[model samples]
Structure formats: structure tokens, C-alpha cells
Target chain A: MARKGRAGAALAIAAIGSFFAGTVSTILVAVFAPPLTAIALQFGSAEYFSLMIVGLISSIALAHGSVVKALGMVVLGLLLGLVGTDIYTGTPRFNLGILELSDGLNFVALAVGVFGIAEILRNLENEHDRDVTIKKVSNLLPTRQDWKEMTAPILRGTAIGSALGILPGGGAILASFASYTVEKRISNTPGEFGKGAVAGVAGPESANNAGAQTSFIPMLTLGIPANPVMALMIGAMIVQGIVPGPNVATEQPALFWGIIASMWIGNLMLILLNLPLIGLWVKLLTIPYYMLFPAIIAFCSIGVYSVNSNVFDLYAVAFFGLIGYGLAKLRCEPAPLLLGFVLGPLLEEHLRRAMIMSRGDPMTFLNRPISLVLLLLAAAVLVVVLLPSIRKKRDEVFVEE
Target chain B: MKSLSFSSRDLICGALFIFIGLFFAIQAYGLELGTALRMGPGYFPLVLAGILILLGIIVIIQGTQIEHEPMGPIAWRGLLFILPAPILFGLTVRGLGFVPSLFLTGMVAAFASTRMRPGTALWLVGGLTLFSVIVFSYALGLPFRRFGPWLGQ
Candidate 1:
């Protein structure tokens, strides 16, 4: 979306379509993923705890750069997450006499500070260098040939996304990446993969949308969130006094069905508004960093304040802004940290519960077959990351041969 | 010398990690830290802190041994303007109400950017203030006072 030039229109159209596709997929999974319903009832605390560890590891896989730095950031995020009043004891952990800090740091503040402000700070240094090309998007829709090329890839992507989306640690990101790999392997014009093939856009777009929607499976039915967005949704549900779990479907059918109805309506609105508003979005991109950033700051501040009409959240955002920038400078990506932050409390809760249930034996994690599998999966991911780098180092030595 | 150079960025990062870990670990020390079987609030935090401290050491080692790009100059101006703008809003929002506070926040932020002209800033602020009022107060019906208690309520 940030890149300029000729492929922009196709990318934009595909992205817009993907938005609606994502919405449809979410509803489909919510209604149809029966296995997820079963898993919700069956999962013990041990299994859930193991699953969270797997989610943490999988998120680590998503971060680029040194493992040590990424892991450190994840830990930092976890520690930050540990702030606020302990649920079990009702005593504040790191509030330090500040009454506002008792409820913990506002997530919106932290997110906006990290993602919005830190990003702007990074971009500001290169403000003079960035060339925002005002290229006219002459074509509004995909051509018939474009549609033909997209169809197969889209179907294949949707399939890939929908399947993976049901997994505990899986979501749109994994789906999109997996679909891209599959598309590249199966594509007839494999050479065109990187250089903006129609299938490239179509496949990932569909898959991303499908994955986004289907990833809600664990969130809605099972109560265990797959990602930070799902965690936010869970938080939203809680604020509305709805406990998100398997029983939610039967107990509050209106809320469940209302969510489904709203999602479809939102998709329809997005499809209608997006293209006509593309010009507006493009115009927004053309705004200079100096002007754009202040606006962002203003909006983020207002949004943070609106969360609880509190001023303390502003300080939290500022503090996190510096931390986020510092981590980014150290080549640590924030996504894994965000994921870790979202899942940290749950991980602690489940781990404690499982341990208590199993009489504190460390072997209980290994004793449970499901928990054992999850641990093995996490170990496998670590090895996969380690093995490839080792091979690449060896390959460098053999290049002359 | 350049080829064998270390990254101060990584060194600072390592130190930061260690510092944060140690801080938390020490704080948790006073708390009840039960065994892993029947863990206390302090136990999990201690474990995480230990992991962080270990990772920090590894990071420090890498920083001292490996060659990487020198850390670039910090955007101090952006940081100064961006960081304070929100604080200013928080301080003033309750006093001045949402619209004026928003305008002031926008103005302060606008001045942060050396490139933004005064006339453009004024126009932009005006537009934004209107938009925020409409969207937040009128459309969304958010609970912020338009005039505020400070103005002789």
C-alpha cells in the first residue's frame, strides 16, 4: 500500500475485495466451524496453557532480526503486561501509588504510541527523502483477463486460509504467508510472482481475507483469542458484560447473531465506500509528514483519552512511544511483543491453574498428550529457524564449487 | 577498525533489558514467590525477568563481537514536539473542553514541524477542530464537555 507506481490500482482493487472477502470468511467460520465448538468444550487448562506458549513461539517466528533482541522485547512486553492489579489478589502489582495505573496501562494508548507515533518518528528522519508520487489511478476496476487470472488463485488461497485459520495460533498473517508460498509453487507463471502478477494480488488478498474471517473461530466459540485483535474483541465483549465462551452462543444468541449481522453490513458499506474513497485515501498519502504526524498525534491522544476519559493514559502512551522507538531502533519488530502482551495474563493464569491441578509436578505438562504435542511443535519451530541459517552459512562456503 | 566495530545500539539495548529485568526481579523479591508447583505472583515475573536477563547478556555479547550499521541520529525535534503535544491535551482537555483543547494540541503539534507554514497550520487546525467536534461530540456522542467546568460552570 505504501509503494507507488503502475501496479497500484490492481493492488488497491484486490485489497478492497479482500476486505469484503475477509468479512464473509469471519461470518462463515463463526457459523460453520463445528470442530472449533467441540474443541472449546474439550480443552483443559493444561492444553490451553501449552497452546499459549505455542502462540508466543509462533509470534516470535513472525519477528525479523536477532532472536535475542526479539525475545528480549517479548519479555519486556510480558513484563509491561504484568503491571496493574493482580486479579487473584486484587492488589496492585506496579501501580506505585498512582490510582490511575491500578487498572493497568490502556492498550489503545500503548498501541497508538508504538505503531502510530514511533512510526512517524522513524519516518520523520527521512521526511526530505520520501517521494510521494501522485500517479493517477486511471483504471478503477480489474479487467476481464485480470478476473480470469485471479479466480483460481483466489479459490486456492481461500481454501488455504480457511484451513489454517482454525488452528490455535493461526490467523490472517499465517494464512496470507502460507497462501503466497502455495501460490508461488503452483503458479504456471512462477517467474511473474514477485513482479506483480495478478494471481499474486488475488491469491494473497483472498487468503488474507479468508484467514482474517476464519481466525475468529477460536475467538468467538472457543473464548481463546488467536491474536491481539481477537484479544481486543474479547475485551470489548467483557466491557459489555458478556463473558466470551462456548455458552455465549446459546446464552446470548442476539449478541452473537448481531455481531454476524453487523459484519456483513460493514462489508457491504466498505465495498460501497472504498473505491469512490480511494482518491481521498491517495490524497491522504500525499500529505507531508510534518502535517500528517501532528494530526496523528492529536487523534491518538483524543482516542486514548476517550477510552476512559482519563489523563493518565496519555502519560502511558508517551512512555511506551519512547520504548517502542527504542525497540524498533534495536531492530526488534513490535508485532510479537504486542501478541505477547495480549496473551501474557492468560498464559500466567493457565500455567498456574494447570500446575495447581497437576499437584505442581513439572512433568504434568509432558504427561498430557496434547500439551506434549504443543511443546514439541514449539521446539520444532525453534529448530526450523535455527537449521536454515546454519545451512545458509554452509552454502556461503560452498558457493565457489 | 570499522569492519571489527561493535554496535552501541545493541549495547544500549542489552543494558536496557538487563536494567528492566533487574528492576522487576527486585520488586518481586518482597512478594510471595512460591514454588513452581504452587506459584505466587512473584514466581512467574521472576522467571520472565531471568529470561530477559539471560537474553540481555546474549545481546551484549553480540554487540561487542559483531559488526553492524552505526545507529543513526535521533529525531530529537520530532520527539520533543510529539511527546509533549499529548500531555498538553491531557492537561488542557478538562479545563478548556474538547474542541479548544484539540485545536491547541493540533497547533502545538503543527508548530513541531518546521515545514508547516503558520497560515496552513491555522487552516488545518480550524478544519480539524470542526471535524473532531462533529465526529466525536455530535456524531459519536462522546461524554466530553464542550465548554468544560473551568469556564465558570
Candidate 2:
């Protein structure tokens, strides 16, 4: 639609869709969070372990490309996560005797290196003069035809996004992708999808915002991060001396309600601010990639260094950047690795605790009904991903983007 | 008869995974492997290492059967300059201070693209450094020295 000079309409549609989705999802979070927290308070180590297993396996399922490769990436990430001092024995495992290794790798450094620096390198691979043509955005309001086309997709997207957002490891990216796939499949004008149908923009935009809003559910209720952003939020909470668990909702009702209220206000502010700032965003797009990347590199260095005032973290950023680029070259998805990195220590802790509780009985996982259900769900997801028909369909879904 | 062939991308990928898996496994083996009821720090890693090795083998086997696309262009220039930007900053930030270290880092990174002229690179880096100093150091009060003792400040 932007290519066809419907930039204003596209932007407005996206803004409206996102606002609607955000409102609905915020309400869903408010209504559902208390009950969810009550249920989560009952969970034990076995349940937590099974839950993380489901999270890990689903990340693998959702990742693009080979299943075996994704699994390997997760394993590698787990090993990397274990690089610091062992929590149980205080034994330094993979630090190579460096004192910095005792504290383990900085998460921000790893994230910036893998996702940020590696992305810059990829963009630099085919550096050419980009021809950015900005069309004057005149019509901010959607036509009646566009409104008719977008209503059902926005509703469907909101529902899908809200549900998926509550699952650990599921977030805006997966929700938007899933929503786009559904819109394409159900649309009578499926051919118009890649060319920018109104449903294509409206559905994914709505889903993305909705997913982002409701991902807070898992974070607020269970203290389980649904995505990296939630992980960062948990980190911040920990810094503030707030233990993020079911008790948080009860103990800090004001803070919990305040965050939910802010979500709605944030959505409203986004629409109010962004509609007028569309021209500024388009101007930013006109900046040359060559000029932009240097600034990115400088800021990344400063940001990473400021985290702990540790220069070693900066070196780690460089090291992980190389690894990230190498993995990209090798066709491995980095998302699973990142997710694994975040979950690794927690997973180990829960596994060990559960085993200790069960007196070394491996059947303890199956003995607990909730744990059994979660494990079964993980198994079902793995099996479905491995199926030949679904595998092909999965590839096709990714290829559309 | 079909010739035995392998996807080089997968072949290299599998070898990398196997190598890393082995590296972790050997280290874990040196640690105490406690019972399942009370897993030592190493036990969990050892299990993960084993899974990684198995997955690597599966990837290798699959590579032999499947004909994959070529690996395409490697970012040699980007790798040459871009990877060092942070390392350079790390090395010099304390000694040279935030301003010069950042300027140097930006200058190096700017050249990652072949399109960047030396003059353009210098201008871009200079501007970035100025902006960062104003925002990060002055405004945000990140306790970075504008000029370190090495600069006789």
C-alpha cells in the first residue's frame, strides 16, 4: 500500500488497528492476570520444569529453518549460559580463570552483539545507494472499502495475539507472523497479500500490538518472561528489589495496576504522537545506511560499556558479534539460542530441584498432572514440527515473508 | 549411481556444533557428576552437551542427503572493520576516554561500507562523537571521563 502511494492510509490503519488491539489486550490482561496468578501460585518445581520445556520446544518449532540446527543452537546457548560460576557449588565451569567469567556473560552484550552488530554486518554486505522515494501522505482516513476489509482481521488478530502472548516464548513477532499467515489463508484475495492488502497491514499490526500488551500477563502473573523484553523487565524488577512472582500481584497491587493503566495511556499517546510524526519517520528513512551504521556502532559500544563499566563486556560484544555472523552464515536461527540462553540456568535449577523432590524418580514429571500436561504439550509440539506435511507447510509460511 | 555429496554449509555447521559440544563435555567431565537426586553443576551441562553432539550428527547426516542453496556472499569487508569497532572501544575507552575512543570506534565502523569516503567517514564519526558526549556524558551523567589521565587532563 505504501508503494502504491497509500502511505497515509496504511499508517492510519496500522495506528488504529494497534490502538484497538492494545485496548482489548490490556483489558484481557487486567481481567485474566489475577486468576492466572492464583493458578501459578500452586505450581511446583516439576511444573516449572515442564513449563520451561514447553517454552524451549515451542521456540524450536517457531524458528525458521532446520529443527536439528535450532536444537543445536539451543544446546550451545545453554552451555554458554553455564559459563559463569555454578550457583550450587561455586565452581567456575567455563571461565578460563578470568574473573569476569565468574559473573558470566552480560546479557545486554550478548543481545547487542548477536542481534544488533550482526544485523549491521548483514546490511553492509550489499551496500548500495538506496533510492528512497517519499510519497506525500495526504489521506489519513481509511476508505469505507478498507474499513470493511479490516474489521474482521483486526478482531481475529486481537484474539489470536492475546492468547499467544500469554504463552512463554511467544511474543509480538510470532503473533504477527501467525496473524499474517491466517489473514493470507482466509482472504478471498490472497494474491494481494505480499502486494500489501489492507488486511495484511491491519491484521499483523493489530496482532503485534496486542501480543506486546498481553505478553505482560506471563511476566506479571507467573514471573515467567514471554520474550526478551519481559526478561529485561524482570531484570529491572529484580534491581528494584521486587521479586516477580504470584505474590507480586498481591503484595504490590498498586504497581501491578499502575503498569496495566500505563499500557492504555501508552497506546493512546502512540496514536496521538505518531500520526503527526509520520513525515519525520519517513525523513529518517532517507538517511544513508553508511552514515547510520557508524552511529549505531558508537552508541552500542557506549551503551554496553556503561552497563557495568567493564571493558571486557565490550570485547564479549565483539566476540558474540562474530559468532552471530558465523551462525547466520551457517543458516542457524539466533532466536532459539537467545531464548535458550535466558532459560538455561532457570531450567537447570528447576530440573535439579524437581529431581531432588522426587527422590531421583524420572517418572515424577509424569506423576504430577499439571507437569504431565505441559510435558505432553511440549511433546505434541515437537512431534507436530517434525511431521513431514507440517514441516513443508512451516517452510512455506516462512517463505511468504 | 548417485555420487556422495555434502552441503558445505551444513558440513561446517555440524563440525562447529560438534567441536563446541565436545569442548563443553570435556570440561563438564572434569567436574563432579552427582546423582540425579542431587545434580552437580556439571551434570546438566553434560546432558546438554550429549544432546548437542547427537543433534550435530543428525545435521551432518541430513546435509549429506539434502541439496541446499549456496552459502552466498560472505561479508569480508564488514567482518574486517565492523568486528573491531567494539574491541577498539574496549581497549582505549579507559585510557583515551569516551570521546576519542568513541570517535575512533565510529571512524573504523564507518569504513565497513565501501561507499564511505574518508572525509565523509570523518565527518560522520565527529558528529556522532559530539552527540554521544552531550547526551551520554553531560545529560545522562554516565561517569565517563571526557578526557582520561593519559591525555594529561
The C-alpha RMSD of each candidate to the native structure, in angstroms, is 3.7, 2.0
Q: Give candidate 2 misplaced runs (Cα > 4 Å).
A: A129-138, A185-188, A235-243, A251-255, B1-3
Compared with the true structure, what per-residue lDDT tens digits does model 2 show for residues A184-302? 89999899987869999999999999999999998898777677677667756754678787888899999999999999999999999878887677677878888899999999999
Residue-level lDDT for A133 in candidate 2: 63
Per-residue lDDT tens digits for candidate 1, residues A75-94, read 88788788887766665776
lDDT of 2 at A220: 91
Clashes in model 1: which pairs?
Answer: A26-A213, A360-B37
**DockQ, Cα level, model 1:** 0.73
Of candidate 2 chain A, the 10-residue stretch with the lowest lDDT total is: A124-133
DockQ-based class of model 1: medium
Error of 1 at B113 (Å): 1.9
Superposed model 1: Cα runs more than 4 Å off: A1-9, A12-24, A239-241, A390-401, B1-4, B64-66
